[model samples]
Target: MLILYTYSFAHMFKTSSFLMISSTEIGKYIRNMGMVCFVCSLLLIIFPTCGYAAINTSSTLSIGHTLSSPNDFYELGFFSPNNSRNLYVGIWFKNVDPRVAVWVANRDTPVTTSTANLTLRSNGSLILVDGKQDAIWSAGEAFTSNKCHAELLDTGNFVVIDDVSRTNIWQSFENLGNTMLPQSSVAYDIPGGKNRVLTSWKNDTDPSPGEFTLEITPQVPPQGLIRRGSVPYWRGGPWANTRFSGIPGIDASYVSPFTVVQDVEKGTASFSYSQLRNYKLSYVTLTSEGKMKILWSDGKNWTLHFEAPSSSCDLYGACGPFGLCLRTSTPKCVCLKGFVPKFDDEWKKGNWTSGCVRRTQLSCQANSSTKTYGRDTDVFYRMTNVKTPDLHQLVSFMNDKQCYEGCLGNCSCTAFAYISGIGCLVWNGELVDTVQYLTNGEVLSIRLASSELAGSSRTKIVVGITVSLSIFVILVFAAYMFWRYRAKQKEPTLGVVDTSQDAWKNDFAPREISGINFVEMHTIRTATDDFSSSNKLGQGGFGPVYKGKLPDGKEIAVKRLSSSSGQGTEEFRNEITLISKLQHRNLVKLLGCCVKGEEKLLIYEFLENKSLDVFLFDPTLKFEIDWQMRFNIIQGIARGLLYLHRDSRLRVIHRDLKVSNILLDEKMIPKISDFGLARMFQGTHFQDNTRRVVGTLGYMSPEYAWSGVFSEKSDIYSFGVLLLEIISGEKISRFIYGE
Candidate 1:
């Protein structure tokens, strides 16, 4: 049953060199060499007993002989299971421990004895017949008149073919069951159900099909699901044009990359990967415990690298329909906005199956007279950072805006989300199997009755108004008290910033100031609308930045550093001392400064354009910067680096030069911002080495990324990487897979 064999003997060498080898050793070697059994015997004629034999096979089935595939990596043979009288034709890795079985020819009807036979027919099919002359198993329907061949490939794929046509008629990979090795699939032919699927074993001791199965569903979004009987246990959420959102926190740890496809004309979906090293072996399998696991071989044994449904949130409907599962909390169910517990008492008792109900009745049900009555009363609530719900209707041949309008125009739509590269997906019924994500995914907008929305809006407006009135009252009272006190006192330190005085008195004494006055908290609160969430730009180690416009219509970015934020304070001081002294179009300009109680703020002239990463790394924005613009960005970054290293007065080294720190002006000019990590070198100092490294990976130079040594040359190496990034539009860490 063995397809091929490999044998080497020392007798051939002994005879050719006229060196004597023991006669008994020669006979033993000849008998052990199965492929060239007679060749060894023939060599024994002239060389005495000093001969050996090696073997290879094309298409041969015998009582004892077997086939070791082309690369001799695996062997196909009839073997009995552990503690079983039944025999089976199975393929196992050659010379490896655990003797892992990739495929079984007669898993259900195993051979009862050693006399069981398996053969490759003249027709392209392979058949296994037991000692009782009972048909145990058979391969695909393939036929031939005179020429048929079977071979085992290095990938461990066994194939039956025709010698004349030389086309593979049958392969083990296409009939996969429980195990999915690299290149082997649970689903094969995309448009056809020639799709391979894996069914778990009936039990630990039985290889018969079990209740659990794993396969890809050719649904709109094309999701992979694991089911127990007909019920779905876990789902690899709809592939987000890029990857599955449900499986969060995927880094470079696993070497596998997955792909999904859906075509009405050619319905297909699949996933596959490549090994990091040649010697390592890996595969994905549906374990008996009803879990999908990715296992890899590390020479000695297989290792489990990843698994789906690894947490409670991974279970389908674990939190019930219309409920969100938050893994970070106890009793993980949370109602969506505008929804309340269906059974408050049951929910209090920790029974979440009742799920949630709309807090307000739908306006459509209240009125039937006019069509516009219900249409205008339905509002959409933005749901961010979520793993979108299931059972979707795919709408193709439209852009995001078109999809949005299409869904918005329909009254039956409950929620809708449009993804790039993959058209629109809309859900109309109850949203089920939804989980909140800590990582940023796509957004989903849920439809709610106007009453629910108005309540939410009213609450926000009331909070805003109350805060505004309180601030106004406090300011008026303070102003009155200050005027009366100033009238009575000879000297006053009341209003800190004023042209009447040349300096302000600090706790340490008097300090001269030329920058704009430290604006009162009330003025800033009014100008930036109390640092409202709507006006907020971004939050960092410093508190947050807000987009503020002066009374004169000048826009500015306010960086409000916190009192306890030592890092932010240092960054602020560094930026002020370094950038404020320089005047360059490629540097962020400091428009003014503010010092309030426990708040240190710096105002910079707001560029119409934002940070470089916002555009350059964005999927939609990347296309806007064509080759010409990308090249310009590269050259501009190089110029900025040259200025920092050579043109600047202090010969500064921008230790951090990531896309995030690079800002753009209206003309698309690149400005280097954030000097927190920048280091100034004394005259003629070429380089410096430190024990601590403070730069992003991929962009960090080899010498600097590995160690804390840096210089102008280090910056040059980093620039080279930046140049390549701009040219190829790929991250450095992703360079390994040609990402």
Candidate 2:
């Protein structure tokens, strides 16, 4: 028995360690498996998020959920405006501030309770339902589809689709809300007698339809109009050839993206406006106060592009019927030449809403034939620079003369105006909303008895003299402008060096001009491949630098100046003037420049090695530049600065000198660039003071950075920092100075 026990003990001891390791490993594996299974099951049972897409909706979008557009620019969801209790489903800018609703589903019927949802019915109709599944608002249209889906388009349009056929059943654009997005339209359909109008919200917090509505007039050459209930609040005036007569600031010179599609046979018309700026979102919104505004998206907020009723004169009928609103006048309202205020006391009190009445009735449209006995034949009195009256009956007249004759012949016609695009606009009955514009307006002719014209002879004589004097002053100004233009035209835009054989050797009038080559904008565009991403080298405070190959097969670097930068046209001219005269091995060579309107570009010889920072700051590429290479770059930079300070004819102070501004050639030779902020000094001038503290920080001297004073010592201080950065392989900005 002892022998058997000894054998068992020996075997137990040998296998005990193996058994312990196996048990431990097995327990760990089992625990891991259990954890994985538990996690998966929990996910499936508790967090079944397959139905959720950012927010959740398979068939219904419950309250507190949202549907985002593909681009994430817009969102369709539920929210209480101004944090109110009433919840409404609406579309709004996802990232923009002010969070104004662009489109509302249940605007008229608010979901008062929390337990409500926007649901898609089996019949392919969308409905907003309350807690008891009772429909609050229905889309009212159905499509033939077993399964349907809804998608908020990137254009800020919410659409319902037949999933099987991918056919659009309904779109928010079709039934527009207050906001008129790029794709939305103000239209009138003749067949169904249906009209699409933008009805503004009651206020900022309430989605209920307000009194103001924006609609397109269905007449030929359709115009945009804002109505206050059933009455016209403001008219955009008649559509001229390219722009509305009243809003003439946006004319043919400005590229307008407004389209008016009219079908005379079908009696259908649509008015839609869009912004062609890439990725720029803009929408037109009519406010409850009857203000029509075109708001452009600028980052997080909206900038107003245009607003109607901008002034008291822009308010419809501010002076009421037959009275004129003048922007230049003190009291603004005034009666026509042959008319008098209906209420003289009210007129004096600035209450011109009572309008005006003709001094004498038209002989043809008189109450009795005896009214014509003392009066001459009815005549048309001409009024220039006036916003023509509303309620016009379009008549097909060939010319202005024909239009005037037609109006004079009609006993009912009270006023007339001839527009370029829209023929004759003859008004019957009373004239309304006539405005005398200081800048933009059309001519309106009012009908009156010839007796009134005969009575205003003195007034006409005084007006003719005033007009004649004004014309003489305008002619004198025009003559002076023409002479100045002729003098300038004789030379090739001062300091702009023409490369032609007969170039100006010394014709420039600027104080700092020596010579320069003026390149065509077209040539630079072609060389840079229209500034494509592949050709982009780097960007600076001023703007981007592009690598381009010219027609001569010579590689060039184009520095496109930024209009919005702190460095502006002054800096551009300074750079050209200084660099054209500057010639040094260490300085960047300016080949030429091109100025096209707002665009200013400087062309230079392309460096194969790009900038020194590319080698010095890059993680992987920093090692490519060794101690010797870095030392050489430092020496070259020093030489360049020394030339600018002492060696060059004009002592230039490169105010923005830094490592990044140092460009490297194929030989790894450093060259100084970006002379935009450089200042030139004459003899004995050591330093200068400026109110505009400009240039790179950290590299700037303490005195210069703090006191706006700079000198050659400032450049030396920047060089010291740059030298240390090159040696230590660390930016002065990145150093962690600990106490």
Candidate 3:
């Protein structure tokens, strides 16, 4: 409509001019036409969103113009930072308030004029052009004549893509600003010295790099670090299995799951997080005050989830080397047990940066005689509930004992800590950034000279003797009470009516079972530490399984049946009879069974890797098993089923088959277990009917679940469900009908 009006006015003016109109009238008419055209041009530039979101060589995004993300979550064009009038081509959250800019294309080179524009050059480079049309900033890709375009992704990554190849050549994520959105990362290349760090703005109003930076250090078992210029400001500690050792706050309840990807060969590591929930907008920002703050917004306002350098003790090397920082203590910093202040006057003045030095030099450091320089020359003083110090070297050792031995063998080893998920970590140099926690902390053992240990040994001996006597008296009283109670009550035998000794025996005689051994109940009780709760692995339909180690150093899984278990003597007998006869590699080898009165136990070879459900369902562990591993597991399970149904002498039907019942060995070989619900098939038998259903839900066939009609096909149906689970990495119950 505006264009039509302008054209008509131009035509009428030309006609009026030709018809000899008055000079003043012609001038007024020309002024009116110019005002109308200017208004139309301004409207076109202000409202350019006519369902298109792209800019080519011919197009330019001016000061008032904008280019939105495909999902409209982010917008990229021109923005003024804080209170600065200097314009910058940046990306900011569309839904967030106060216009939180995540990425700035020209943070340091801000355009001074409103006529500044963002343009995509024909050479396939995105450039920020000033009023003079001079390029201020460009996406420094090699000049290419190929068709290419720049796009703002919903993930807040601005990318320059090669349209012909549909591949991103450059991205803003690789050059992170102060804020790290979901899927954005802080990457470090140790070998190449290339780092994508989160450097704080000079201040709230400034977008330039500040003194503080958050980056992943290029250390063995790489860790996240916050540095102030060239010095360390805060340390995030080494990455443990699930989280960073120093940051205990990142746990199961955290809003977003933190992930660290490390490539040892490539010498690179990256820290990132996934947006598991949609309502919450989470980002980690490095504040100008040298604090790394993790904040999230839920539509209304931003909430601070966590912040590093949260306490005085969190400051990097707050207590210096060989000094422990305990927030609960009045002074906060103290010298280690075997060490004294290097400079007593400085320490008294609260200047602990001068750390502490060993009071008695290590025997290894002294030129002592060979006999005197033995293991007795030094002892380890155990410090419990403490965060292990920085600059640790990870060593290969099986257990805490081996870790201690390995450290003792090294003369330069200063201290060692054995973490549960992460094994032996030893430090050869000064222990810095040590902090004490109230609970759930690793134990660090500092090596002390024999002279220092001798003073404490006498005290330890006296206390040990006192405690031992007290424990002995208590045990005697407890044993007497147990004996008296047992004497007063009748011993309950197996609930079976038969009272003969043979009643405990199954179809296979003890002598006939060649490989299986009938273990004593006393041994199992000893191995499991008298059924300690700590030793319990998990609970099954029948009973709880406990992890135990035999006297011969063989680990075993003891499945003890509870008195209140749904499966009674029938199931027990069936399991012992069926498993004893089966000898396939994929089948869990039945080491032995114990039938001592009311106590019934099934012993199986302990698989170090535990069950399939553990790795299959765990978010952190699921990546360990790739597609090839899953395929191998599926094939192993199929072979085991084939052996049970067709190959074995006795045809068997496993009524329950699920991820939890599938045990993985040390080598990750799958083994089928839990035969309490298994039934044997007679000759030529194809199917059987029962009034009661006996299998886990979801995996059960429709006919078996509804009508209690089960056969070999029922087991096959369960396998099919298991196969789907292995491929999709989801539980059968979670699978929707249509999906």
Instruction: Highest lDDT: give the candidate number.
Output: 3
Candidate 2 local lDDT, 325-368, one digit each (tens): 88774538999878899999999999999899988876787344
Per-prediction tally of clashes: 14, 0, 0
Please list the C-alpha lDDT of all candidates, in the order they appear: 0.67, 0.78, 0.80
- The Cα error of candidate 2 at residue 155, in Å, is 1.1
Q: What lDDT tens digits, residue by residue, belong to model 3 across residues 1-739? A: 0111122333544665667977898799889979998997787555674233666666777777677776678887787778687777888877678678888888778788769877777888878888898889988876665777776777888887888888887788988888899889999887888888999988877787889999987777778899999999998777765567776444211222567888888998899876633344777889889998877777567777778888888888988899999856453789999899999999999898989989988876523444335376888998866777999998989777899987777777888987644678999879999988764356799988987866667888897998899899879966876776666565564233332223466445664453456788889999999989999999998899999999988999999898777987788878887887776668887888887777889999999898898998899999999987898789889988987888665789999999999999986889999999899987788789889788899999999999999989999999999998898888878846774
How high is each candidate's TM-score? 0.60, 0.55, 0.59
lDDT of 1 by residue, 1-739 (tens): 2333236555546455544667887777667776476774455444321211111123434345455665566777766545456666777776667766777776787666556556677666677776676777888565653566676776778887666787877788877767776666655465454666788766555666788888877776777888999999888777655466556554111113565555556666665544433335766667677888876676588777778878888788876777887755442789888899889898778788778878886655422554454567877787756777889888874666677666666766778887533568898878898877654445688878887867777798997899899899879966976786676575555533231111121321222232334455566677688888898887654568898878777788888876554565456656656664443446676776666644667778787778877776679988887776766667677767766776554588777776777788776777777776677787689899888787777778888878789888776776777676667666666745444
By TM-score, the best candidate is 1
Reference-based lDDT, residue 5, model 1: 27
- Between candidates 1 and 2, which one is better according to TM-score? 1
Name model 3 segments beyond 4 Å from true: 1-46, 49-52, 251-256, 276-280, 329-331, 366-374, 451-739
Least lDDT summed over 10 consecutive residues: which range in candidate 1? 48-57
Worst 10 residues of 2 by lDDT: 1-10
Query: Which residue runs does candidate 2 get wrong by more than 4 Å?
Result: 1-58, 251-254, 276-279, 329-331, 364-378, 456-739
What's the alpha carbon RMSD for model 2?
Answer: 21.4
